[model samples]
Target: MKNMVYGAILALQFLTRFPLPVNCSMDHNTLKWALRFYPFAGLAIGGTLYLIYNLLNGLLPLYMLTLILLTLWVFLSGGLHLDGVMDVADAVGSNGSTEKKIEILKDSRVGSFAVLSVIFLLLWKSVLLYAVLDSSENELFIIAIPMMARFQALLQLFVFHPFQNKGMAHYWKQHLSMRDVIIAACWVLPFAITQVTLIILFSLQICFSFIFGKWAVRQFQGVNGDTVGASIEGAELWNLAVLYSLFLFGIV
Candidate 1:
C-alpha cells in the first residue's frame, strides 16, 4: 500500500508539472511501482485539460484555446517527451551508423531536424485539437488520450530489448511484471466504460502501439529513453488524430 502511494506520487511528480501534497523517494521498489501509475499521471493531465476547456471554452476563440491547450499539454510534461522527440529526430535524421545515431541521441544539443520535427508536431496537434474541440464530440477524449499515451510508454517494457543494460530502464526492468501491466491496463478501463463508442479508440491504440513498437525496434535496434519518449509523444498525437477522424466519419 505504501509502495502504491509512493508510486502514484512518483508518476505525478515525474510526469507532470502539477504541484503535489508531499514528496517521495525514488528508491528501487518505488521506481518499479511507478510504471503502474503512469496511467494515473496521464489521467490527471487529461482531466486538467478537460477542466480548463470548460473554464475557457466560451471566453477564448477556438484557435487561441487550442494553442493554449497545446501549450499546456507540452508544458505539463516539462517538454520531457518533446526532448525525446528532438533527440530521436536528430539521431535518425543524421542518417548515420547505429553508433553515430546513438551518439546523437545522447547529445544535448538540438539540430535542424529537431526544430522541424517539433514544428510539425505542434502544427499537427494544433490542427487536430481544433477539429476535435470544435466538434460536439465528447471532450473526455482529451483526458483519455494523454493517459493512453502514457500507457503506450509503459508498453516499452514488453516491446523491445534494452539498447544496453543501463539507465532507468535497468532499474525499471528489474521490477517489470505482468501485475504492473495489468494495473496500468485497469486505468484504461474507466474511459472505455464511460463511452462504449470509445471501444474502437482503445482498440486502435493497442494496434498502433504494437505497430509503432515494431518500427522503433527496427530503427533504434532496441528500446531506449529517447525512443520510448518519442513513442509517448507519437501516441498522443495519434490519439488526437484518431479522435478527429472518428468525429469526421461520424463514428463517434
Candidate 2:
C-alpha cells in the first residue's frame, strides 16, 4: 500500500505541475509503475480541484471558480497534452498525405492550423463548462472530468502501439500487468455507480477515441507520444461535450 501511494504521488508529480516532493529511484521499473498508477494520481488532482472549488465558493463567483479550475487543470500538465492535440489538429487539417501529415506533426514549429485548433478546443471546453456549471449535474462534473481524462490516457495502453522502441512505453508497455488493469477497474467502479448513464456515455467517448487513435496510429505507423497525448485530450473534450449536452436534456 505504501508503494502504491508512493506510486500515486510519483505519477502525480510527473503528470501535473504540483510541487510534491517524490524522489523515486531513477529506473525503468519505477517509470512503468508510475504510468500504471496514472489514473489513481488523477484522483488526487480531482480531489484538489474539488477542494479549491469549495474553498473559493464564498470568496468568488462560480464562474471564477470555473475559470480557476479550468486554467489550473491544463496548466497542471504544463499544457503538454494540449500541445499535442494542437499539433495533431494542424496535421489533420492541413491538406496532405499520411506521410505529409506525420511530417507536419513532427515539426517543432506551430502552424496556423495548430493555433486555430487550440483556440477552438479551449473555447469549446470553457463554454461547455460554463453551460453546465449551474446544472444539477455540476457535482458530477467535478468527479468525471478529471477521471475521464485519466481514463482516456489509460486507454492508450490498450488501443495504440508505441511508435518507438524507446520513450514512456518502453517502460509502461511492459509493466501494465493484470494487476494494473484490476487497479484501474477498481478506480472507476464507484464513479460508474454514481452516474451510470454518464459513465456509459463517457465509456463510449473513450471507445471512439480508441478507434480514432488506432486509425491515427496506423496512418502514422504506430503511436508516438504526441499521438497518445492527443488521444487523451480529444477524449477529454468529447466526454465534456457529451456530458454538457446531457445536462441540457436533464439527464443525470
Best by TM-score: 1
* Residue 183 displacement (Å), model 1: 0.6
Residue pairs with colliding backbones in model 1 are 46-143
In lDDT terms, how accurate is model 2? 0.71
Q: Which 10 consecutive positions of candidate 2 have the poorest summed lDDT? A: 136-145
Candidate 1 segments exceeding 4 Å error: none
Q: What RMSD, rounded to one decimal, does every model reach?
A: 1.5, 2.4
TM-score of each: 0.95, 0.87
Candidate 2: segments with Cα more than 4 A from true spot: 1-5, 26-29
The residue-by-residue lDDT of candidate 1 on 69-89, one tens digit each, is: 998888888898899899999
Q: lDDT, candidate 1, residue 125?
A: 89
User: What's the lDDT for candidate 1?
Assistant: 0.84
